[model samples]
Target: MKILLIKAARLKSSASRRHDGVMPPLGFLYLSAALKKAGYTDITLLHLALEGMGREGLERELERLKPDVVGISAMTSEAVSMHMAAACAKNGRNPLVVAGGAHPTAYVSDCLEDPNIDAVVRNEGEITFPELLAAYGRKAGFEGIKGVSYRSGGRRTDNPPREFIEDLDTLPLPDWDLAEMGRYKDFVPHSPMLYGRRYMSVFTSRGCPYRCTYCHSIFGKRFRAHSPERVLRELRILKEKYGVSNVEISDDVFNLDRARAAAVMNGVISGGLNLNIFFGNGLRAELLDEELIELFSRAGVKYVCAAIETASLRLREKIKKNADLEKLRAAVKLLVRRRIFVNGFVMMGFPDETVKEMLVTARYLWSLPIHSFLLFFCRGYAGAEMCGTLPPARRIDPKTDNTCFVPGGGCSSQPAWKLLAVKQLTTAVFYFLNPARIFRIFRDLPFRDARLFWFLFRTMSVKFFSPARR
Candidate 1:
């Protein structure tokens, strides 16, 4: 069967579009590999953002390709766009539309509620998707396929949940050939501390054991990782074949298994593959130690983003973050001393959190020797612990809601506007106090690329000076 998979873009505004760059949809790449293994060779992968395609462009592609099935992967922020793509597919060629990824996995019924979407694949799609296709090929009922939700006789029928893949090493390598690697190279996602011209993202592991309130455990809390040998092989391919000099390790927790993590890093060094690495995904601060930091530096890790959600111990515990402030501070200091760039991921405007609490966390971050701070207003995503507990109206679209400019409606004790003001003030004060960070950023760029400089400047301007206050 001819199949088309689309990775939808979430940006609505022109400004947001400029800031957002397309990262390869690793999920779809794996799915493509799975399909190819299942004997479905006629598969096409389309990344709308990377291709600069809109709904009309997507419709045209659907009409031209005339595929039997179209699968769309999206995050919660891309809900509207997901529906639009599904609608376009349905109207153009009447293909069997399937929706997957974090958003659909969390809201299965909500996604299937759309008439255009024929089914929703939950969680891991590698095994379930192939089975789904087999069922469709045989013209068999989908009741037997696990981990899929579909419409049956005008009623939604959800099959039993599928188990998470225990042996991540067993999965086939992602079908990178199907992706537009050249276009991806031209318009690469911006990484704060990445050094190389050619870069790509790699996931060495799956799942996180931590129970952060704002996080969804779609992969469950059990951590399963690819063996170090398998990881090294992939790295070698990216280096030798793709000319990828820099890699963003996108593991939820890269350092979860200290020994395994160390082994992987050491293997990179031993192999003489001197690739610049950055952990754009936030790493757990409490897990870092001097030994690990040294290993990271030796492994050519240029920068690390640590999840310092909130500095207030009370708030941290309340949110079930369970992070040690002292350990986080030490980690930041050690990374800085080792000449590694440190970026702190800070969140503000919790349900009952006060402006004082938010500022306290902000002040704590500013006091640290970190190179940059990523300030985000707390968003209660679907399937997260906070989503169930928060009032329905309080739940804001994570894509459009700038808690820094508009109040996150979830807070009852604080007005949304006040929360916005605090967020803006905290950002202004932190950057204004540390002008050296600006200089350090310029010094860290591998080459004097105008695009990179413009990205940095635009990002900072939007964060500190955007007139989107509501």
Candidate 2:
């Protein structure tokens, strides 16, 4: 049977292009390769971003492909749009719509009978989905499928979760051949450093070792990584074949195993794959030392991003961040001395957080001598370790709304705004507070990308200086 994959349009609040201008849907590429290796080649992959397409344009493409099965990958924030896409695909027709990814995996029942999605895959579908589709094509009862959820007799059947793939070396590299790699040729995210060059993201590992409360822990607490050879092979392919110069290793924590980190770094260095790499989600601050920092620097790692979720020691302990400020400072200093840029990721407002604590975090974030900052609000998805701390209604709202808001919560106050007004204010305050220095730093950046830079700057400015009326 013919299978089609539909990539839903994601919200474009921030235009941070890392590789040239557009980023390819690598998740779909992985699945496409798996299906092809399983002997399913009658597949068509459609990226909504192509042709300047939106959701409706995707619907038109769906009608054009008209496959026997349709699969959509969704994130927590894009649930509403994904459901809409699934609804349009189903359209009262029987194309066997299926949903997967972080959102559907956590909210299986919600995604299953949402009137738009026919079924949901709870865990890794790379292997499970091929079997499910084979059974569907043969008109077999799907009760035996292991990792799928389906509506049956007014109740949902959630199959047991599948095991993680242990040997990633066996799997083929993602099927970039099916995608228009040229579209993603040079997209680069907005950043203070390396502003002109293009960079793309790759995953050398899956899962996280530490259980950060706010992170969606659907992947479980065990860290799994691809072999050094496996990682080097993919990196070489990305650099040699795709003209990719910069790579971002998007793992949950790259230094979970110090030895493995060294091996990967050494492999890249010895393999002669001299590509600029960024440990985007690699190492938390607590894991690195001077030796590791030196190794990473020698391995062509452009930037090291540490999870500096908060500066309040109590708040950091509350989230189980496990980051020690003193050690974090030392690591940052070492990287700074080595001329390597260090980026910090900070989050605000735990369930028990206070305004004062948030201010402390804001102040501490500005104090850090890092290359850049990425601030995010806490998200509580169902099945996450953090979800237990949140109130019940906010966990799974039956109201099928697109906008994610919790009344009086950290995110709700800024419902109309994508980011917290205070966070925006803080970012502006931090950046503008050093205007001449920032202008001097980014003076070499092209003027074409200034629109996004200025928009974010203005967004923060408007929210920062407004007075409180009594």
Candidate 3:
């Protein structure tokens, strides 16, 4: 069967990009490889971001490909746009549209109610989609399909639980050939330093075993990994086959299991894959130690980022982020001593959190011996422990709560706007106040790149100065 997988762009206009036009969506590549492995090579992966494609572009592609099935991977942020695309597809060709990601998995009911979305693939789409195709083609019951929810007789039916992939290594390497990789070279992970040229992402493991209220509520608290050997095999391919010099291990929390993490590092070193590994996904601060830091350094791990979500122990507990402040400091010290780059992730605006807690968090984050840090405003996703527990009056409007709402489930409410503003400003306050931080960022470059430097400086300055404070 011909399958068309689309990776929807998160931005409505071209303003969201980082100087560069747009980058290929990685989600589509993963699904394409999975679909290809299932004997569906007649797959076309359309990246809306690179093409600057919108609903009109989606309709045009459907007309061109006439794909038998349409698959969409959307983050909560892009739900509204995804819905528009799905509606266009349905109107243009009526291809079966399926969405799977954190958004859909968490808000299955919200997704099911959407008339345009035929089915929502929950959890891991790597395994779920193939099963869905097989079941559909056989003209048998697709009801038992694991990790999938469908609408039948105007009602949403939750399927039996589909187990997580036990062996991540067995999966096919992502089909990077599907997207224009060179366009993403300059895109860095919101870091102040570093040449944005040369960027890529790879997942060394799946699942995070943390009860960090926000994380568990989004990605589930189970930590699973592809065997080290398997992980290294892909790393080799990334370097040799795909020419990816920089790779982000996009796990929720890599190194949750030290042995597995060490195994991965050992495998990469043993395989002699010459590449820079980035922990773009946050790692647990409590888990880092000298041995692991040294091992990661030896293994060519260039930059590491860990979560220091809150300085307030109370807020940390409320988020279930069982981190140790002392250990976190030691961990940062080790990385700094080794000259390895480090970044910390902090959050603010918890239910009972105060500005003092936020200030303390900032103080603690700055105290850490690290190259850079990111402070984010806490957003309560729908169906998360925090969201589910919110009082009816306090409940976020489903339309605006893009953080956890299923792709295409439109609930345009004021709360989402507030949440978005919170996220933007929290980041602004952390970095804008620290002039030394920005200078540290500028010091890395020579005077010759003044144009690019100023471009970024002005861009960031505008954001820092004019924060979306309500």
Candidate 4:
């Protein structure tokens, strides 16, 4: 069977290129690997953003490949692109159009509302996707396929949810070979700190136990991890087989299992891998201690992002982020002391968040030893617990079609302009007051991508001065 898996792109959006760099669509890659393992040989992976393809380019590929099935992976922001790609897929042929990813899994009925999409594979697709394919090949309908929502006789039907995969060790290491590994050379996400040689991302675990209200909990709230041996083996494959030097352990919270974390670190240390590791997604900083920090250094961890979503205790409880802020500060100090670059991940807006709370977070960040920080306005992405209370839709102005120079509306009780003011003021203050941090950025500035810096500037400048804003 000719199977085409497309990584949907937000081609028309002002999506940050620096943030969404040319990452090997790890989810699609895993699915391809699963398909291959299930004895399906005819699989092609197309990354729309990485390939710089628009609707026309996608149409051309659908024509050329003549695929039997077209699978599109998308986030909420890429929903429009997914539909556009699905329309293109259905244009030339009667191939099955399937949508899967955070958006579809979370809002299955809404995703199926589009006539073009035939089905959505909810949650993990490693097993269920192959089962769906086998059923399709056998000319049987997709009725009993667990973890799937499909159009049945012109009506939407959802099957029982599939159980989360327990033994992560059994899943194949992402088939970089099948993914055309060479094409993604030196392409990590567009963080200046993330620039390194031959980068790839690894997920040593699945699931997050903590219910961060703003998170899209596609992976269930249970901590599941590959064994220590399995973790080291995947790294070894990347290091020796693919020559991957820098890697991001892109788990939601990698150190949730302290023993597993310790064993993996010990294995990396004993194995002599020397792979430059980073935890860009973040780590549960409060979980770390002196030993864990030392183990991280020995394991070649170069960068870590301590996720301190808020500083106000009241706000933290409201959002279900139960992080110990005091411990987080100590963790940041330890990371910095070990010469590991640390960045703080913080959010500004919430349902009842006050300017006072926002300032509390800003000031708390000043007390940490983090070399840098990312302050994002909280978005009400579908599937998050925070979505209903703080709907981003109400915040956007149709005239500008942006959460932009928002006049009166905002996601939180606070106005959009107020949140913007707080973010800008705190950001400016954070940097201006910290001469040491400024020096760190410049010292490493020469090694960073100049194009990325300029592109970011251009994107922001255009957004601020566009005729819509004026």
Model 4 residue 301 lDDT? 87
Encode model 2's per-residue lDDT on 210-279: one tens digit a residue: 7677677655678888888788888888889877777777677878888888888888888888877766
lDDT of 4: 0.77
Q: List the candidate 2 regions with Cα displacement exceeding 4 Å.
A: 11-22, 49-52, 185-199, 392-425, 434-470
Clashing pairs in 3: 185-197, 185-198, 186-196, 399-411, 399-412, 400-411
Query: In model 4, how large is the Cα lDDT of residue 96?
Result: 83
Clashing pairs in 4: none
User: What are the clash counts of all predictions, listed in order?
Assistant: 1, 14, 6, 0
**Every model's TM-score:** 0.94, 0.85, 0.86, 0.91
Candidate 1 residue 112 Cα shift, in angstroms, is: 1.0
Candidate 3 structure quality by residue, lDDT tens digits, 329-403:
888788766666677776665666655666777667766656555555555566567766555654444354433
Candidate 2 at residue 410, lDDT? Answer: 36
> What ranking of all candidate models by TM-score puts the best one first?
1, 4, 3, 2
The residue pairs that clash in candidate 1, if any, are: 407-416
Which numbered prediction scores highest in TM-score against the true structure?
A: 1
Computed on alpha carbons, the lDDT of every model, listed in order, comes to 0.80, 0.68, 0.67, 0.77
Runs off by more than 4 Å, candidate 1: 14-16, 185-190, 193-196, 397-413, 445-448, 468-470
Model 3, position 159, has a per-residue lDDT of 85
Model 3, residue 18: what's the lDDT? 56
Which runs in model 3 stand beyond 4 Å of their true positions?
11-15, 19-24, 186-195, 216-219, 392-398, 401-463
Candidate 1 similarity to native, TM-score: 0.94
